[model samples]
Target chain A: MSSTPSLWRRPFLPARILRWPSGKATPASAVYEHPLIVRYCHWLNTIALFILAGSGLQIFMAFPSFGPKIPQHDLLHVPPKLALGGWLGGALQWHITFAWIYIATGLIYVIYQFASGNYRQFLFTSSDIKGVWPMARFYFFRGEKPPAAESYNALQKLAYTFVVLLGILSVWTGLVLYKPVQFSGLAWLLGGFHLARVWHFAVLWLFVLFVIGHLIMVILHGWNNFVSMITGWKRNPDYLP
Target chain B: MVEPTNNEKLAHHLARRDLLRLSPLLLAGALFIPSVRSKFITGGLGVGDWLSEAIFRRNHLAPTFSTSELTPFDQFPLNTYDVNDPDVDFDDWALTVSGDVARPGKYSLAQIKALPLQRQNTKHICVEGWDVVGRFGGARVSDFLNLVGANTSAKFLYVECADDYYESLDMPSALQPQSLLCYEMYDQPLTREHGAPLRFSLPTKLGYKSAKYLTTLRVTDVIPQKGYWEDQGYSQDGGI
Candidate 1:
């Protein structure tokens, strides 16, 4: 409601606040929306996530079933092209290796978001609930585009918040599967080893779905939005005054 | 409003400079280069091994299932890299013990079984992701190590199987109370397919680490041959 930006909302780097020859602000100026650390973590985590998913598929090919080993009933076959490592051992190496990268990037991102209080940009809250239906209508039913008052809309905030939580769940479930005995208490909380495997697999599919939706939105939003993530600036964001 | 040309140029320069700041991330692309790919993969795997080993608790036990939860004996899986039944001379079969031990000699199954027997219903988890809970009975490996006067401080316990399958265990894992020189399963003598005579039953490690058809057991610090699957790129410290 205030014209002045909050301390957390201010760009880490100075924004290009341009003025006309008459000293009036112009829309041609650029705002630094993403911090350097945020962009770094984003690209690195993206690469790690893809590698994890591909190698995970290869690992699943080892036992493709949630049933008993003796009477093994394969649930589904993941195509070799969709998989990363050539074999089980090879897949395990990739999975374990990238798991560290994935965890590191995720941890850094979450810590930075909280420490800088930048989480407000995408954290969904009760205030966001009223904006959701309007954004959904505009996106899905060609309704009038809602006025952009902030960096992210309600729907975008909801999706980002959901995916971040999903990322945390993925890591927890993965640990349970990797060392069920060592994390026996956690495994028990998730309904034992067998159920934990199921939950991990389910989390993978949800991640795949989220990635698909995210890609579609990125393509629709075009280069301006995409460039903001890479170069940390948006030339004419709708939210800019 | 039309921006001045100099202002536009400044924005362009700032964006380019910001993009260049992320050039260090381009190093990640080195993973695509064939020459260095294996090194990265192995290095990553090594980190994973180091972390797992660091957190391993020697006394912390793997979970045990109730009798009713045990996987039926008939349904228990027979997993082997080679022949399911590696023909061994049962009459002459004795675990040859060597390396850092006061009594480095052949130990008969009778000698191992003579010690206090332990029965447990523990889970057997495979690297391939399948798992089963089965009842296993054996003498505590620690008891045998004590009887043989083994240097418990040794870093590794290496074993070679009749099937040519070899495995090594970290001394801490080797000394777990649940670690056993297993000779029985499902309250019956181990079948030929299940590494009869002598084998390892370590609930804390993956299935492959519990090598079947035991022929030689050595207490040592150096492992010339890590394990059958390990040499093929599996983690050496395959702790569960």
Candidate 2:
């Protein structure tokens, strides 16, 4: 498939570009799109998220049923195949341990994003909102040409921003569930433990959806995306700033 | 569209077609096998419990709350059986201390309450993810163990409740200062709705570990095989 001449059926769309400091070892010809700190946090997040998902599923499965009880009512339940943490004890252990890692890495990522001023690249401005429809059309409606510009497209910015907010919500809800008494005020603010639990579980499914979309987009974008994440530099000279 | 160079082609580990075909297999593996699934869910899970257990000192007490912080009574009612359950008989109740104790015998409620009494205001953490502060008055589990001359070397304290509920706590938790054989709540005799005659109030454990309507105490060297919910897959270490 790689040898099949054209990876894109149409001319490659231009993307918004951001210039970041390059490592001394990096060649001047290629742009350093992702810094080492970003790469490290991204990979660490991959580990933390996966563990949390499994253990969280395990915890959820202990009760298995959700929502108000009305006999014969259709309530959503996670199938056993999708659940992690074989037992309640095992799941709690996994969940608690990874929760620390997830929180730590998340903090570092936020700090670095702000410190390095890379956060600007993720800003979704009014213009970005206007661009969303066109971008959606370009992807879904085959003949439309994608908007050309810089580092990340408007849709990418919107999605990434939403995900960041979602991550924060997940952690907040998790804490409310984990220590309701200590965080009683916070729990009450979110409408109590049961409501917080529903949000937590729903956010998990949102993450699953996000993962699916992220993988598909990366695949469509080709090896440049993976290579940039892994190596901290874009391989395609044309794709670089 | 730009053509991919030889290096770029080689750099690609999977073609689009291959990824499409392999995705299903990856999903199935994640759903069935822990080892393969854990590749996606990677962490130091094997050492987590060990580390937590090691760091979780026996004397480390759960946070205490004031009487003001005590959870409202009507809001947090009895969880087990309702007030009318026939299984609980408070009128003819006696606590039988047996197994590895030096003196094995039955003691009435009046006799048990006659021992040195203590009161504690501690958080009652529930495993289902809620907590409340309540004042429990009773003999310290350690003191009761001593009264019965329980075998100090025993590994577990297996307790049975009149409600047919059973629980087993580890030796260390059984000896924790906060662990109590509670006979009173809110400075009043326990209501029938609560664990009437007696119950174990272990601040270190989740609500379930504090068995209500407690009827029997068995000091044993063998690790308890199962508790009512532990058999149903609840965490044995019900600690926070």
Candidate 3:
């Protein structure tokens, strides 16, 4: 091995001790958590998703939806002031520019997950399935402590995996819409161009909901979650062993 | 000799340098904000349009279909200022060629029809997420241009429609094999609903670029005018 010290061996912050009446103690300190690749991917995804959402809203406003052809009376309109790109051409420009970036970053994230065997952290086992209720109870405040979680809890793994799948769906649906004739097979498989457009719009809303949930969880988890994402480190005062 | 542990070094490296590098990127990203968005940044769209044109090529043939697949002519949307402009008399209706052309006069409907006929059953894609395959028959724009002795050296063609609509085509797009000056649809003469007498058919462009009810075709070296919708912020190139 090279002379440079391994990344995991970095010194952690001193543990904060919480003494219990029954002589129990817990030590919390900043501990290395996210990898550099993970942090980069996370931030990249965040930027791309936000841009995509806004620009997508702009494009959606142009046609609005599939309905009875009644001239300009389409339902579900988003005002231009609230949307990015301002105009259809501008929106198209933004959407296409960032689409490539979004796709490449997501691909890199997947490659890193498989190549580094980090996919295991997001894979829930039978035991994890069994622990769901207990974990839920802990979050619901019925239990004193949460069940053991290494990298992610079962619920988190499920949500993350679902979001990743949604990302794939978004890209696929977008492709079908972008070049319906060129990828006619994919468009046909998705039940036609109109249906593909619907799926693409639906997935965008799903991403919006996912972002709201993610932010709420980050707030609930407090500074540790935020700091770990930024610095790839976490402090757990309740550390065991 | 032992140096600092890897995590400590990583922590220090991130705190001191990565944040510094990332700040610029983040600041640059803020330029995408709506209120602050600039052409300097949006210039990428023009770049993308240019790149797409280069890769896809103006001469690229759009997929054509058999006549059986043609969407009924009546189903095609009629989008114009005046569907039936009172000023346009069919008997007097002729496409006038001027500017850089050697033949600077009007060509009657019969003359345009007699030039050389090319037909295509191709998808007419609208920007508003709808498309219809229609069988359009007409003279190839290139053939018509050569017939009028248009300066093929010109950079743009300013197409003015009888309905007061206007659009300019890049020289290459104007010369595309699929580009046509169409007068017939579904094996019959076009109705007023479609561009009758004649309309520019650029299957390579979105539906809007096909100026309908042709009044004038001016060959020019520069883009002297913008299309009605182009002025309203539609893409000038109008490629897919």
Candidate 4:
């Protein structure tokens, strides 16, 4: 432990407890679950993703149909309150601007995770598949709480991995929509220009669903788990011994 | 071991340091300020335009469709900011060519028609997100530019329509093989609602960037005013 950098030292070792000073004598059971880079990227990406989604809705209002323009059949009306920018032009400004920020933070986070080998903490794999059912049962069906063996549970890893893949898909679809002629090959792979638009729109809704579930889990996990994302430390985490 | 004074204090300090590291994120919040908001919006659009311009390949052609994929002529939406018909006198109308051109005079429709006709089945994409494939036939803008001896190095090709709609195109886009000074659609002469005598059919650009009812064509470096929608906050490049 003395040979390792404090930030990266035995990150999952719950037994390596920290003892308080004599004045405040207590064993603090805390874990540095999130690195500083992870926390920063998480919050920044949150803001950018929100703006992108809101502005996207406003842009969608310009043409609300997936079919031909002549016999246009609108799918649904996105309420003005739910949209960010005032109009199509305004929305595009927001959408295009934050798209860069979103991409930048996402790239940095992904690169950092891979380079530092921190992805092992959350990246889902075949080994996690069996643990998922138990966690899901505990959360949804009143089954026994699975003992915490790692920083993130199997279900959490699955969700995180799924969202990352979704993020990549959204960016690809968005690029095709932005420049169908320039990225014609990508558009073709996504089933042409019209279908690319459909896919981009679908990705946005899937992101919304993920966010909703994420928020519910955060609340259920209580303040300690939520603070870990902000402060890079989880105090009294259940996973800590 | 040296005894730390207070564990709660140490924890608070650690959290504060971590929180402060994210101060750079505050820059995004500057968008909330009313005075700064517009500037950010313009800056964002400018960056987007810069990126669009960088990636645009002059040689690249917008996808061409088979005639079977063509949208029915009646179903093609006729979108106009002002009036569908500006009621131009076709007999008196001529394309006034000016700026950085050897021939700075009105060229008659017959003179333009003398050039070889090229026809294409291309998609027209609107900024509003609808697209339609249409058959357009015309003389390529490159050929017309050659006829007038235009300075090919000029930065922009600006045009004004009889309907008071104005648009500007980057020179590269103007010289694309698929770009045309169109006079016909669906293999027939254009209707009054469709900019009859002359219009632009640029497959590489957004619909609004291809202004209808062409009247004046200028090859210039400076654009006093950009296109109508662009002036109203739409993207200036307007390339797909």
Backbone clashes in model 2:
7
**Steric clash count of candidate 3:** 4
Model 4 chain A weakest lDDT span, ten residues long: A10-19
lDDT of 2 by residue, A1-241 (tens): 5654343233333323444456755443545677666766676677678878987887876554454321223345667676667776667766876777778778898787766567666767686887888877877787475645666787788888888888899999987776554456777788866688889989999999999988987897778767887666665444333
Tens-digit lDDT string for candidate 4 (A1-241): 4677555443533323444444544456677778878888888889889999999999999999999999999999998999988999889988988888888889999998877768878789899999999999999999999999888899999999999999999999998888888888999899888999899999999999999999999998999999989877788777655
Name the candidate that leads on TM-score.
1
Ranking by DockQ: 1, 4, 3, 2
| Candidate 2 chain A: 10-residue stretch with minimal lDDT | A7-16
**lDDT (Cα, 0-100) at B188 in candidate 2:** 91
lDDT of 3 by residue, B149-186 (tens): 98998878998887788888887888888888998888
RMSD of each: 5.7, 11.3, 6.8, 5.2
Per-candidate DockQ values are 0.62, 0.09, 0.25, 0.60
For each model, chain A TM-score?
0.90, 0.82, 0.82, 0.90
Off by over 4 Å in 4: A1-26, B1-25
Indicate whether candidate 2 or candidate 4 has the larger lDDT.
4
lDDT of 3 by residue, A1-241 (tens): 7875444343332323333344346343455556777777777777768878888888888778675233445769886676877777777767766777678779998887766656666656576777677667777766756645365777777778889899999989987776555456677799866688789989988998998888877796788778888877776623433
C-alpha lDDT of residue A64 in model 4: 93
Model 4 Cα lDDT, one tens digit per residue, B1-240: 776679967998988875567554666667789778788877888897999889889898888999899999999999999999999999999999999999899999999999999899998989999999999999999999999999999999999999899999999989999999999999999899988799999998889997999999999999979999999889999888
Task: List clashing residue pairs in candidate 1.
Answer: none
- Model 4 pairs whose backbones collide: none
> What's the lDDT of the predicted structure labeled candidate 1?
0.89
